[model samples]
Target chain A: MSQAATTIYVPRDTTTISLGADQVADMIQTSAANEQQRLNVVRNGSRGLYWLEPMLEIDTDRGRVAYGPVMPDDVDDFLATECWREQAGHPLYLGLTEDLPFLKNQQRLTFSKVGLIDPLSVDEYCHLGGFEGLRCALKLSPQETVSQVTDSGLRGRGGAAFPTGKKWQTVLDTRAEQKYIVCNADEGDAGTYADRMMMESDPFALIEGMTIAALAVGASIGYIYLREEYRLSEEVLNAAIRLASEHHFLGDNILDSDKSFSIEVRLGAGAYICGEETALLESLEGKRGMVRAKPPLPAIQGLWQQPTVINNVITLATIPTILAKGPDFYRNFGIGGSRGTMPFQLSGNIKQAGLVELAFGPPLATLLNEFGGGTANGREMKAVQVGGPLGAYLPSTLWHTQLDYEAFATVQAGIGHGGIIVFDDSVDMSEQARFAMEFCAIESCGKCTPCRIGSVRGVEVIDQLGQRDVEFEPDDPERLAQKVLLEDLCETMTLGSLCGLGGMTAFPVLSALKHFSEDFD
Target chain B: MITEMNSTEEHNNGWQASVKRILTELKDKPGALLPVLHAIQTEIGYVPGESVTLIAESLSLSRAEVHGVISFYTFFRSTRGGSHTLQICRSESCQAMGSRELESHAKQSLQIGFDQTTSAGDITLEAVYCLGNCACSPAMRIDHQVYGRVTAEKFDQLVSALRTNVIEVK
Candidate 1:
């Protein structure tokens, strides 16, 4: 009798690899070879259920059977067992990969095929409705393509929340012999891995999106400004680009058409300020990552004084689906002005921390409780910082706010980068506030006085406040003076700073002060 | 101790040669300073101060310009690092998961603070913002290998193992 072939799935995602997934994969491969089992191992992306990472899935005649947090020592027993045939008696077996509540609940439009496909395979990407967008894009005029995006109501996912279609239209209107499409993959924001996940898992999607952008804006060359820490992303993206180019999806005369586009990956050298669009442009030009003054926005005079279309990785990755499906189909998923699905990353002290892609306008409480599964330690949740370091720290009282951009704005918060970092009751909001100032100081480009000098002063003022023991009374002179001074400093930094680096530093500091008043004591 | 000192000097000489070779190879590339700096640090473990002059002269830039670029980034170091680097994420996400306690444990165990090398030259501790493994809080990287859900005990075990050279980290 002929033996049937067995397929084993392992994640090559960074988070999974960090938990010794590679070692587990090696063991599985070696053990299968030694046992002479007809096994094929494929390294796929993370399923976003991190608690069960090193999560190996085996394709059986019944379905895909899952095993989790698998160690190297368990490989022998795993291979010996008939657990793949049935999930009845195995301790590690998790039946059916998709049935997991954490994954099945998510509305994964952008991240639909992340964990399902082999990341680097162009054929796999094509099979999963990848190039249909580019094919659709090739037939449309540049104005029509821009209008499609405008009709979709996609905003910048990189925290600015600017309309993406308008930015593209501006670049399209500009007359330049050589324009560029820059994908901002410099995801330095804490508690955010969506950009990295998109780059590492569905890299070709980002390339396809950028190619679509290139076709839309009439730009021939592009660059992905990637963070330095994402070494794996760099490798995967470059390989995907090469594969796409080889398949005639990129480079000269793409897909036997007049359109041509090429992309190069540029690594940022450990500067958080480089995540800023202007600073990123400066870093790309081999200069200090100082924030450039605006008016001549990057869309107008960027990358050697030529027009450029710069969009975040998620923003670009969302383009393919929008182009393939109609604009209304994409727009129907979201609420209010923030149309479309967002890959909200839950981290910090969360119990079931991972990427949760959902349509906007879900109550903040639902994400914190339902998606995150509350604090990992079962401690009382103190605060949740929506967005990155510069985002506001909201107390539990404000948890009812919706995840829409305008809704967050009403509460003096911005959903910057869609990263929610939960903090338990054990957290000291004062220390967090101080860290905010310190981070700004360390990452400040020193272009503006309010950010460079004011951040240092903000730290000193917060330290002085920590020393004081006065209650939160309006008439308490010493306390009142310090509060006023801190507010003034925040105001200066917010208004006087050259870029968002200085402008948004006040968010965390001021929000912590406002919400966690007891922490100040 | 004397042999160790002599070996350190010999290592410095080798680093100089490697830096020169790297500069020669990457000098002509467009916007090569950052890449050149990255290559030097990758090869020598840290960017030495004297090498800044070498880089500036090769790239036809002022030493101040080179120094500004190097110092602007936290990853580049002016002095030599220890044999292994242990970078603990100090960002709010990791902080929420008792990284502060783990950081204290790491410092006490190594008898060194962040950005400091231990007296034994075994490990250099540094603070990174985020490792993109936020799902696994208290994430740390020992050299290029990232370890997640790192507890005080797990950190200590890794440190001792690294000090003893019992197992290669990767």
Candidate 2:
């Protein structure tokens, strides 16, 4: 470790620095150069403080001193005063980073390295203790490695919250000539950029995680099926793969262990349905994005009819931690069966909308109030959408529910993608319900009738309710009945659709209707 | 940069040149229903009809396809563009929080839309599908910038201040 006493942490979040972080970073570098100070500068991911970034942190006797909302012009004065060491007042100084209750109270696991390292630099990754999982996995027997993940209780972060280890173990147990590892980087969920941020900020972690998956599954080739919108992340991740290949972290004879694994990236054309495992596999094979029937699930016949282990970006990214920290360490953080931290994306109308990695079952109220700082506009909280478009809308009455996967589900909601979107009193639950149906209508892959045609009809019904047609008055018993019918229609879509694209929409729409019926009017 | 130009140059081969020449030949006629723009795009690569005249002469009709084709599909762009045409879906499904307004904002900011161009010519803006990211809705793409749940203000600032040169010229 370079014992460089002076290191600076600057946040590179766009929302935080309306003026931009690049200019501030350059200013810091230039000032550091003039002073002949050996400054270890890292363009860490956002600390989720959209209000304060380009936030500069300096090491001090008290703790890591913090300054933020820093602009390029202020860099000179920031250094000239050396006030950070003295705790002298500077307009940019937002106080010690660890003291911020928003960051202090929360647990960080999946996002441990975000906004803390150069996302592209392997050296920075190594310094921050990345690839430790890969190192551990290389030592463990394949079965032992699989067992470790199983013991960790880490579920998929990709909405379903499925057990990741079991999914990988199924592939390992299968006897097939060709097996594969596919990273579901197709993060189509609204109010969620955890996958994108991770890919852009720590591509190696994901790559390292995927490499381990390939080893455990007896697979040789790994594919990262990234959405086309994430072009920059694709470039960064590809570059990291090339670097990892050169360093023997990937490619033939990885880690000199006789295990050969090579990873490649495939871009998904604009298709929300492609986020589904089977649909994603189909798109990878050059077909129009459409869902495929499961049961001959992806684990058995996926990605060109090969037994493939498909995991979301965050799920695979957590592999290194599970291996490095031991299953018990990884499993001990969260409540009940939902162990380990979730990379929860705080977005939409929230005040401090950004990625937050916290233990499961944190009260949605606490998440919104303590960490998120409530809705951005400071209006009365009306409804909060947990998960994505298909996620349920938790009205203010249900705000006390714990945010664990099962707990949220108990209330007819799921923490799909761990994205919490806040809506103030101004939000109309009726309009939201209608929008959910409209969204499903546009996104359904036309593979299954229940999802395709049903979603379109669902939208029409919601529109009818919105327009206040003579058929159903707002407060009429028939209106409630119509809502129930729509909910039932959603249920059929949930059970019948090929994937979450159609399934998840029901979660939010139904919850909105059930919890906040008045808003629908 | 090399990859972009090589692909464009490769796409601009004899077939495309021949198509461009023919389109240039039929520059004028009443309504010139050659549908030359789409026909030329199909014949060559994309709608290379930079001007109304080029589209007019290409097919034996007037520049109707040039106008009609440009307006018909969301794909056509009159101005020269970067290698990738990143069309972000900005319809109602994506517009619950203002994607409808975002489309116009993106067009004005990008200095192009429906069939326009940015001064940089690196990206061409067009409306796309739910982009299959409706869960995240209000999504945008620029050869790969899949920003979701974006606001009009954020979109405007991102476009106005984007430093596309982040990628090194390989």
Candidate 3:
């Protein structure tokens, strides 16, 4: 086989694709050919530095030198320069890939392979030490495998922060003819895209992670309940499953042993409620995506009334590392109760919006200023919405809170899915608070009255509050009554909702009122 | 009851035959309602009025159950739309990127509201909560192709090209 002189790496990530990466890739191949050069092009996944997407990299003696945000139109002009290593006044040059402070500072445990490898090559995945986790797990007893995860202190990354090992143990102990392992890929959070990135980046890691879960819990069947909006992830996962099956990593009698596991990709309709596990189970049954009450948690009676294990994409994806390197290796990264690294997705008005996989101890200020570099519009920063739409809107005063679960909880905030959405001073807190209630009303499953009905009422109350002239009439009885009623409404929803939809919608509204009360006036 | 019967009668034999084919292919799978619904929507632009009763009967569900499932999710629409579906993200991430103005520009340019088709029947504008493209905010998806950081100028150009059939919507 004749080797190509040089290789060009262009990301096929969703964000890059939307920025016209495919067009750039096509142009690079043609332009290099015209220069009498035999250049190989490989479509890899994004490094999560989205602003520089279509971030083209080339192999050099120093390492993978990067340059980017390259349009198809710029490909010929840059190739014509013939001074790639020397920098030669090219406008898109970003220096070496590893030297970028945004990536160099990251503690990336789960996202290690994301932008570096061709996503679908099973040989490359294995060759780079991929399936060692499953191979290690096969030798241990099911209880032992579960114990390893428990000792690692890994909690569910899917917002609730429940211990993943405890949930798996509940399913493992329960006797049943069949058990199910479901990976919740219904990441509907407005400002988060880590789950989508991981699935599109390294599909095999998820497959391997789920296989380990099935082995630990004695589940024969697995399903990845992916959201419908992620059309690209669907394609990547289907192809990955096919490839893994061919290698005997899946299906009956895997790897010359008496083990069997298979995963099916099930699509969720546009219901945000399905992100809630019980509602997800209901939707998987081909019914309306409604929430189920919790007398019997999903661990004991789930799916078709059988034992089940449901975990978020990050929680499952982290499993392979824990099993491969032992619990201590994974446990040493985090602080307090929250173990391992969290893939914090930074977006919105932030100048350097991207994913930062760091251990759970950095203050919110570090992530916002150091990695994010404040708002993109060069304005003063105002509020930061942590978690998702349901999360609280924090003011500058709260920026010192560390990224730990317990630490964020102290400030009425959360590390839910590790999403940090920055906003400029132009943001109207009252409007954001109103939108929180409106979003809940739109997405609530109607399983409980407070979430279903209270959200609508919350919207109306906020509208009336907005109309009141607080400057002229500080003693207006009607305005005072409405403010009390708004607080009461938030209280009722937090106490009475069946799921997080109602329970947490008040977080943003209440926080906005407490911190940015002037906006309400 | 009479209207229901009339609507079913209006459905051609070809529609019924394809619906039957979809049911036969997916009926045996566990929790097969969603896959069946997706297949039907894929075959036709939207879930027709008459197919609910047929789906209910085939899947051993009540007619109310079928209707409830369709109405519960925003993705499933009851009526057919234009050649292309333009879903603008209305969630916070996009909102922070000035999608509020883009929302206005899109509605004015097409003379349509969310879930409504344009007057010329070339586009259907819809509101989506999020498309998982938050890093590149102010995102909109036309069919499967998502466009990011869309300014009002960019929006106008895409709309004109779409009207002229420059890109395949499907």
Candidate 4:
């Protein structure tokens, strides 16, 4: 590895700021030459404080000593006190990054080395224990590795929350010469960027995780179907892949362990529905992003009729952690069936709107009141939408409910995606309910008749309810007709749609109507 | 309808001027949906409905299709935009942290709708699908500024200081 003194600090993760990193990096390069200091600088991923990004750290006797959110104006001051370990005069310093409460609290199995090392540097990644999981996986039998993951109790973080090891084992059991590993990077759900943050910040982790998936499922090739708008992330991830292939982690004969695995990232033009596992496969095959009939699941016959192991970025990313920490260690973090901490992007009208990693089953109120720091406007919290648009709108009464798969289900809601959108009193419930229908209306892939037509009708029904004018009979038969239509629409959308886009929208819309019907009138 | 690219060699007035001339000539056409949109977007660098009446008369298609197509694609606009068209990808990939809620919040802050320009005429609010940068999901675009893994607070601070000089009818 290169160990020169002058440091370049470009944030590899989307969560990190590069607003001032460029100028600071330039100043560091110039200052080191001016001061006759030996320099080796490379841009690296975020440590994930977010509050203290574009952060520059200096290599010292201990490790990379930290200084952060450094601006162009701080260059001379920073150079004046070069070694941050001794005279770290910068206000951004919170001592070692390991001590930050936001970072320290995280169990960090998936994100273990995310913000620490140079993402593109294969040597740096190895030095910080990057391919250790793959090395360990290569040592074990494929079924044994699958068992290890199964015992680890890791579930998919891509909304469905399915067990990871079982999915791999299913692909392993299925007979196919051209088995594939597909990473669902088509993250369309709102309030979710954990996958993007991990991919951009630690591309190697995803590669390593996918490698593990390939090895466990006895697959050779993998594809990461990402959204089209992430151009910079594509460059960074591809660069990382090149670096990994140059090493023995990605391409043929990885680690020279008699295993040949290769990966590619395909860009989806722009389709929210493609985030679904089967729909993603359809899109990967150069078709429109639409859901497929599921008698034969992706595990059985997927991705051009080959058995496929499909997992979200977070689900695949979690493999390395489950491998290294041991199943028991990873499984000990969460309560009930939810056996690990989930990273949620707390957004919308919340006071503390950023990435939060919390164990499952914490009261929703605690996440909102303590962690989120309550609503953004200080308005009384009206309703909080958990798990993206398809998730339910929980009124304050249900705020005390624990945040877990089962707990949410008991309340007639599901954690479709771990995205919490807070709403203040000013948020019109009827409008939100209307939007839930409208979003479904626009995004439904038109595969199932109920979802395609029902969504459009849902929007119109809500519009009719919201409108003050349209006259009805003295008994208002239209209202009853609309109610019947809504129930039937939700039932059809719930059962008929191929994936969550149509399936989940019913929950939020129904919950809103059931809980906040006053808003509808 | 996908319009093929036209050559600029024969018309030295530049694409923007040609688009204006075309729009002016077609201003009085009734039901000017397909013709105005097709001609203006084809002639100008992009679709700009500066002369609505010219568009209405010349194209002879309904004003509705002209309006809907402009709004639907997310790229077309009725008003002139700032020097930079800062768009944040509000699709599912970027929505993890309340991108939808943040969308409404941002619109409220900018005093603009999905395709409307701000009162200051510095920026326009629009939605885009997956930046393919899901690694840093919850992203947004500010004109050409592509910001990923955006938090509500960061998005607010990003737009708060933006300044640009341009104007047109909404």
lDDT of each model, Cα atoms only?
0.89, 0.72, 0.90, 0.72
Models sorted by DockQ, best on top: 3, 1, 4, 2
- Candidate 2, residue B68: Cα displacement in angstroms equals 22
Runs in model 4 lying further than 4 Å from the true structure:
A1-10, A17-42, A54-93, A468-484, B1-86, B89-126, B129-139, B142-144, B148-170
Give DockQ for candidates 1 onward, in order: 0.65, 0.08, 0.82, 0.09
TM-scores of all predicted structures: 0.94, 0.79, 0.97, 0.77
The model with the greatest DockQ is 3
Shares of reference contacts reproduced by the candidates, in order, are 0.77, 0.04, 0.82, 0.11
RMSD for each model, in Å, please?
A: 3.8, 8.9, 2.3, 9.2
Model 2 lDDT, full chain set: 0.72
Candidate 1: stretches off by over 4 Å:
A73-76, A468-475, B1-17, B166-170
Residue-wise C-alpha lDDT for candidate 4, range B1-170, written one tens digit per residue:
11212333243345545655766765554223434454654345356553443343345545564454355433345555654555665543344345676777777777778766667656767767544333345567764346655677877777655641232322
Error of 2 at B40 (Å): 17
TM-score of chain A of each: 0.97, 0.91, 0.97, 0.89
lDDT at position A17, candidate 1: 89
Interface RMSD of each: 1.1, 10.3, 0.7, 9.7
lDDT of 2 at A318: 91
lDDT of 2 by residue, A59-89 (tens): 7777777786676677778778764464457
* Angstrom error at residue A283, model 3: 0.2
- On residues B67-121, what C-alpha lDDT tens digit does candidate 2 reach at each position? 6435432344454565445466644335444566677777766667664455666
Residue pairs with backbone atoms closer than 3 Å in model 1 (clashes): none
User: How high is the DockQ of candidate 2?
Assistant: 0.08
